[model samples]
Target: MSAPTAQRSVLPPRPSYAAVLRVPHARRAFTAALTARLSYGTVSLALLLSVTRATGSYAVSGTVLSLFGAASVLLMPVRASLIDRHGPRRALPPMATLYGALLCLLAALTWRPGAPAALLATAAALAGAFTPPMGPTMRALWSELVHDRALLQRAYSLDGVAEELLYVSGPALIGVLAGLAPPACGLLLSALLIVAGACAFVTSPVMPGPRPAQAPHKRSVRPSGIPGLLAPVAVAGGVGLALSGLDLLVMAFTAQHAYDTALVPWILGALSAGSAVGGLLNGALPWRMPARTRLCCFAAALGLVIATTALAPDLWTLTAAMTLAGAFIAPALTTAYLLADELAPTDARTRAGAWVNAAVNAGSSTGALLTGLLIGAVPLGICFLLSGGVAVGTALVAGPRRRRYADRS
Candidate 1:
């Protein structure tokens, strides 16, 4: 056999998730990030219930949540830019502190019934504005920690799976706490978790210091700032839009079939479980395909699989179909983050990740709103098709083009 053939035949053993944790200080930093991120999972439910109880109005509660989510998602890039400029050690702690204090204040105000609605809304929005960009920051840190591309892929996968689990379990924990005590109690716990986790994360020895300030005249500017990030951001947004709509579509399907609404969680759980499995498998394998190509393929596959969910005949079949669709979710997201990391300038890594993060959140919010409107007006199957089409179309648009622009002579 030739040297290349022989080398290909004797590839090294695939690196395990254990290899990721073995990176020095990775465990502590990752653990801290997860702890802080759990607050995100719990805060929505806790805040919703607390606001509802305090205001005694669903409309008010909904408005408050919208304000909070908008502030958090829309301002993510701004907060991340500060971290990139000032360093996480300096930027993150203050954000966490202020966020925690706002949560505390909101909890206190909601603890007593009849707090002013305007006051509550203002406080929640402020809290969201200060919410630390933990997920993006952690991904940026992962790039710093793992030198090998394959190893970094595994780290992102592990991080994705853990974050998914945190979200799944966070609301369950809040549900239990809500059963025992007031919803504000859960909100208070959220505050504590973020404050403690942010402190721990910043103090980790592996975390890097701040980037040097750029001179005003030396700073580079692109006309459409995020041109390099277009593909990843588009794909990420498409995935988010599809996934968010899935929940509502499933609900409508179950309701039409006269199936118990209680079964909704189990079906959704299958999607999450499938995503977790796919993520683990994606990271474990060593593939020859380039990351960019892999991203396009993963996204296209997800869109196609999700489109098939429109034809499911029953809840069980729908659950299975959704699980299959979900298999591509994490791998697509992992590849997007990888691409973002590669395309971003070193000094603005956090901001780059944040843009991807923001795309997902913005798409999700828009999806939920649009899907809700479409549910009563259009046929459910058609809605599913539209949802999946969003992903497929984005994948097509974001895929690499053959044409290259001529350089200015």
Candidate 2:
């Protein structure tokens, strides 16, 4: 008898870039993006409206926001650790529910004409602590859905653009709502939206689960350990500090000149719009600069923009300068994420992402506090110039070390 024919194996045809994005899972990831944006948008509006109305002072608003930011920074690793252990679905729902409930409580408690500052601060801290790890989980899901690394990069770029749109439209929407109704109305609506968006995200078919072998560690309190995480963490923290300083400088300047505080939202909106535009351009451009170069360019450009704002002669010029300055925001943020991904171990990606987030929030808080203190003693423009100079100096010192770390990794 003739020898049995040897079995032959065939490889599946490779998918095209377009095909990957069109996959069902990838489509779900896109939907998740929209929901995530809506959720965060609502939270942002609530924070802005609640703090400003309760304290009747932008300084207090900044302080409350800074506190909320600190809460998020402190809790990010814990939330990420949960996701790393329990899978996104199991971990996210409880956190989201708690967060939504707390938001509602905060809104209800602060509805009075003059809520106590301590109470408001407590509410803000709770909201931050319980806010689900949507950003990182969504990103983790994106990694699972897309088969190609280039596609993953593109996906992240698109997500960054979406974030720009969220910040741009979200705060403006909040401001409009607050103008029309009471700030509490905005806060209430924010709670509802957060609940809706978060639930939708958790239920999405594309959300990934941790492998069965990687059981949720009941005792684990920190995110999975990863090498070289500190580098990205440091860079992110510095960038956050710079952005927070810039924010405070603008607010202080506006307040000192008695410019309509209404314009504050508009200035922030311009920055967001610029970031969105930058992300779009980055996506369309063929040149993919090394991550380090992108970081350096963005940091330098951001410093210049802040400095220019200090020199603007009128509101229009200031807004224009802010818009121009925003061009670097997305690039810098994107590079930070890329570095985090590079440094993170396979099992600790979510934790690594959280580290980056925490760094940014910490830096922002520090910068805001520093700038706020200086505003009382110096001219706003001088504070702006000083902040910008500090940002530039920090970036220059950190950029080289960051690049070296990236290379070693």
Question: Best-fitting candidate, measured by TM-score?
Answer: 1
lDDT of each: 0.90, 0.70
Writing each residue's lDDT as its tens digit, candidate 1 over 194-225 gives: 99999999999988888764444212322135
| lDDT of candidate 2 over 1-409, digit per residue (tens) | 3344332234444444355468676766566556655667766667766767767877767667767767877988888877876787788778878887887877776576577778877878888898786777766676667656556666667777876677556767877887787777776776676666667777778776763423334234343345555555666676677788766666766776779887887787788788778765655454467665566667777877787677888778888988887787777777677667766554566777877777777887788778878887987778767766655765676565434354453
Candidate 2: clashing residue pairs, number: 0
Window of ten residues with lowest summed lDDT in model 1: 215-224
Q: After superposition, how far is residue 82 of candidate 1 from its true place, in Å?
A: 0.7
Ten contiguous residues with the weakest lDDT in model 2: 1-10
What's the CA error at residue 82 for candidate 2, in Å?
A: 0.9
